[model samples]
Target: MHRVLDILATEDGDVSEVVNRFRDIENTALRTAFHNCAVLLRMLEAQAGLTPTWEGGPGAETQQAVASNTKSTDSSPPTKNAPKRRFTPQELQPFVDETQRGKVSVAKVYVDGASRGNPGPAGIGVALFTMDGKKIAQISRAIGTTTNNAAEYTALIEALKLAKDLGIQQLYVLSDSQLMVNQMTGRYKVKHPQIAEFVAQAQELAKQFAKVSFHFIERENNRLADALSTAPIAKIPNQRTDSSSQELMALLDDNPDEGRTE
Candidate 1:
């Protein structure tokens, strides 16, 4: 009934024309269902402060007369707070045209994870870019305490969530964590019970898109996301920090591999 109401709300046709469209259905059961639907529609119209009168010119007058003779007055009115305005067909026609003509665009994403110690202070970073290399968004957040792999999984989850928000149909995920990429792509089995839930969440998010691919890259090629991952550690004042800036600098300067290629 609501679907019929929504259709009628957007169309400019008279009620009789609407009824005739339903009446042409060859199935007796479907015709009976449409008849009941039409009755419910008339009652709804009356409740919306409109008098139920057919407007299909002189031919519809007889149909309206027969309907009026059989109709009852037990119908309830619309609630006082019911919304008044509805979208017209003209307003939504452009959306229909665009849907039929437009093609889905793909988005590329980069993700990196960081931890001060193996299972210590951690942060996750994600970078979103268009197919043409234009950066769309970057996000970095500190997770209280977790392993490097957990942080990596968290970053992938965050990136997928952002892609969903952007309505991206295709995604290419690049990450420096081979373990994360392998596990997400089903090449490696998740052995740790602690990180299993996070991996499951990432897999669920991947299903929301039409297509997604994960790639592993050396840390050198993932510099932007790596820099974002370490930004928070660099912001601490020397006086209040446990470690000096030089030590932090050395940690950032250390390469995951000395002779790795992009």
Candidate 2:
């Protein structure tokens, strides 16, 4: 809404035409806002030009219809296909430039995990953000049935693997799960035998990086990764426990800690 107001206030030439174009919007509140802003714009123009009355040309009837409909208290919901204002050519380039900022070499990785019913269906989400905080890559996938903490470790493991694939030497990792962060940092021990294997795999992958750090972040600040973690079951390919996760676990279990103790 604020963006629309800025467009109306700054756009040059045929402001009334632009105002009329938005009059067909089905949302009463939005249509009314456009109408009122148009009126104020005309009033300001009249004062500047020292005119007797503001000129609202041929589209004046459409404006009146918009105004009249705005008064209707009918509780019908707004139409889903309501007209939306498009960004002008001037606005497109900046958006593109902003999005491209994440294509750099170093990135911050955010990971999250979600489970439907503890050991029920589960998924993990990983996002890579460039130094300037633009997301360059995102991964969300169903990892079959798993416990919540196991899913969290899966997210971390996936993130580390992605960072390795990207050849990212430095990673600033963040997750909403404090337990996962602590386990990765070795502040907490991995007691679950199965989870310990996954944790060991993640630690091995993290070794590939020249430098990597993990931090516990608040859930609100991790919205993108969190949203991806809960992707619909239909959208993700279902995998069995005997597949990738287990394969990686087995590979790590063979070594049992790179010929050392944890």
Candidate 3:
């Protein structure tokens, strides 16, 4: 720590010294490990509202450019209580050293749920990714008859289960279910009894992780997981566990397009 600080404090925080020090780490995997640790440290600091005080810290130029772009685009009158601005990729670049962007251990998961009817056949999907946006693993499974919100929570639960199985400690989850996200974040009340129960289950599962974050993305942005969810339900003959064929599916799946339980 002292050596790193000394390097950063030198020559008005000239990062060339830091680069040179990094180069001294001859082992490639060790270099990536160090870089990943630093990334997590910086995230923890940011969570505590701490910012780098060192002069000429990493990505200062890009950070300024991003900020400038942000200010330039706020020309329109701001709406009242405009939902907290989504943090774009551009805004998060300053935290990562460009050289080590793809090597960081922080991971992300995109999840989605689908139901033909609110209480009709349902499915959950999950797609986990590495820090650099590489898809690592995915899941698409049907979970019988359930409410849409329950399916949403089931998707989250399945994602968490996969992440935990993969030994992931830091996770960022994205879902197209706005109701699920808002309720998980305590922004909305869990009104339905079934949904409330699932919410508790999800929250308890989240506690097993070192960190878990949930965000709401539009359905279009969540195509992969959305497709995964739809697949298990869309193929009725094969996806069904019983000998029930297309005709039985038709009977159970009537008005499957309706009964959207939020």
Cα lDDT over the full model 2: 0.60
Q: What TM-score do all the candidates reach, one by one? A: 0.51, 0.51, 0.54
User: 1-262 in candidate 2: lDDT tens per residue?
Assistant: 3354343442222233353357447888878887898689667644432211111211222443354356544432222113433333332121112343423445577788887655558888777765444446777778887767778888898888777776676677888877677778877666668778988888788889877888876565565667667763435455455456655554443332332323
* Candidate 1 structure quality by residue, lDDT tens digits, 141-202: 67755557777888899989887877777778988787677677776666566567988999
Candidate closer to the true structure by lDDT (higher is better), 2 or 3: 3
Model number with the top TM-score: 3
- Model 1 scores worst on lDDT over the 10 consecutive residues at 92-101
Q: What digit string (tens of lDDT, one per residue) describes model 3 on residues 1-262? A: 3234342454332233454467568878879987998799667645433332221112232343344345443432222113333433332221212343334345677888887755568888777765434456777778987656667788899888877777676677887776677778877665556667888998998998767888775554566677777777876543334435644543433332223444
In Å, residue 70's CA in model 1 sits off its true spot by: 88
Model 1 clash count equals 0
Query: Ranking by lDDT, best first?
Result: 3, 2, 1
Clashes of 2: 0
